[model samples]
Target: MLKNPFLDVEFVPDLMWFIGQFDVYDREETKGAELAVYNPDDECDREKLIVKYGLDLKCLSYRHKFVLVRFLGEKLDDPNFDFQSLFEIGEDCAGSWPRGEWYNLQNPKGFLQDVYVNAKKVWKKDLEKAALEDPSTW
Candidate 1:
């Protein structure tokens, strides 16, 4: 019953993230599409973990609803997600949603890597407005 068509995957330890729903305009413009980085194991704070991943405050912005997730607890050597860039595009409470496609990048015999490496414009919604809103939804 989710609006987004992306699947959740944890390739590396402490790096659980979704490939779809990517709305970052540029690598530095990831503020609007960033999901929260949580420490379910109590090893580090959210901010600290984000920093370790080279994600800065400007790189992430919260949206309306939060996605529930936990970081993997292990180490992955150069586990190239094979996706230098990824994003999502859609809206909640909208009926005319686009056809959803669920894909697992890690799957063999898939073109996930080839597409992303040569992608020019990815479709993704900008959810920064939802994150910076006041506690009271005015």
Candidate 2:
């Protein structure tokens, strides 16, 4: 009984392409540097999603980042999906800088993998719905 219907789709190249533009950096190093370094000028439908979600690049584990891309791809397939809500959710999920000492001390990969798994479980219904609707074109 998934509520959102985009999770079941296959890999989305467009979303992946957009996600590839952002390179994760050390939280401290990103302070003064140009944010544009991570984002290119290439325009696409996924740009807005990138802008919101990409801001959390540093906080996300490398693998967890892909989840966002896949999620976006699913949303793209749904004509009725609300772009505004997606953007808002992205903003809410953006991680904060100067991560706690405990967070910095933990294994980032392991931590993020856990996060990703939990997220998938929470959004499973939505993903299943999406997959059922479009069956993933790609």
Candidate 3:
């Protein structure tokens, strides 16, 4: 049912090594952590579809964030819903970069566990380090 044949494959590790950099911060934090934006367009071959829906290597490490973005951009083949769009969605769900509180995500409860919750789980250590280090003067 998909137009692009490549967007139907499974995502692998090589397609998700970008999240090793970002650290998730909670509310009330003065400073936030920096994330390495991985633009696969620069590193990998475009013609070859790594995942069925196109994976954003940048959000790979943050499982919840990555899944949420993928959910936001279901139409991976649509030119309007490509990686950049996913980045936008990620920013939307995860709040703006440099530690802004524009769209803070709520922790998931009930059956559907929120992606941000899981993402924080993966980046907790890094986020802790960033929080304790202080960001205003830096």
Candidate 4:
């Protein structure tokens, strides 16, 4: 039997996890709970596809990474993720795990659009491979 090219709805979390782990932070410097997570912090699930295949995850996390694979070949065929400004916080990881935030965008979802504009060139091969591989394989 042939398999579907789109991502299975159930795989959303894994795809998100493949990108990185997310956490909400309540910072006085920013209103509401600020979203944060370290990029490519695969400590939780490093044995997944990208790692097994030896492709670099790079600094491009969920935001930019999602574009090439289309949320694992399912979402953003039109490209509106419905996120905010999207800032890259935490200049220093301080040598800790899982780095920092996830979404936390106040600028506009379009900011990610700008990043996606060049995503294929940046993560073309790696994204394609990970998207095609079974997350449960590991």
- TM-scores, each model vs. reference: 0.16, 0.29, 0.22, 0.30
* TM-score attained by model 1: 0.16
For 78-110, candidate 1 gives per-residue lDDT tens digits of 365433223222444222211222122233112
**How many clashing pairs per prediction, in order?**
7, 6, 4, 13
TM-score comparison, 2 vs 4, better candidate: 4
Q: What is the lDDT of candidate 4?
A: 0.36
**Which residue runs of candidate 4 sit more than 4 Å off their true CA positions?**
1-69, 72-82, 85-107
| Model 2, span 1-138: residue lDDT tens | 211223554433333233333333344466314333332222331243234443333533333334463665565557775432211223445443322322232332332233344445554655465545543332
**lDDT score, residue 20, model 2?**
33
Stretches of candidate 3 exceeding 4 Å from the true structure? 1-113
Clashing residue pairs for model 1: 14-72, 21-87, 21-88, 22-87, 22-88, 62-131, 88-124
lDDT of each: 0.27, 0.38, 0.31, 0.36
Name the best candidate (by lDDT): 2
Identify the runs in model 2 with alpha carbons over 4 angstroms from their true place: 1-103, 135-138
**lDDT, residue 116, candidate 3:** 29
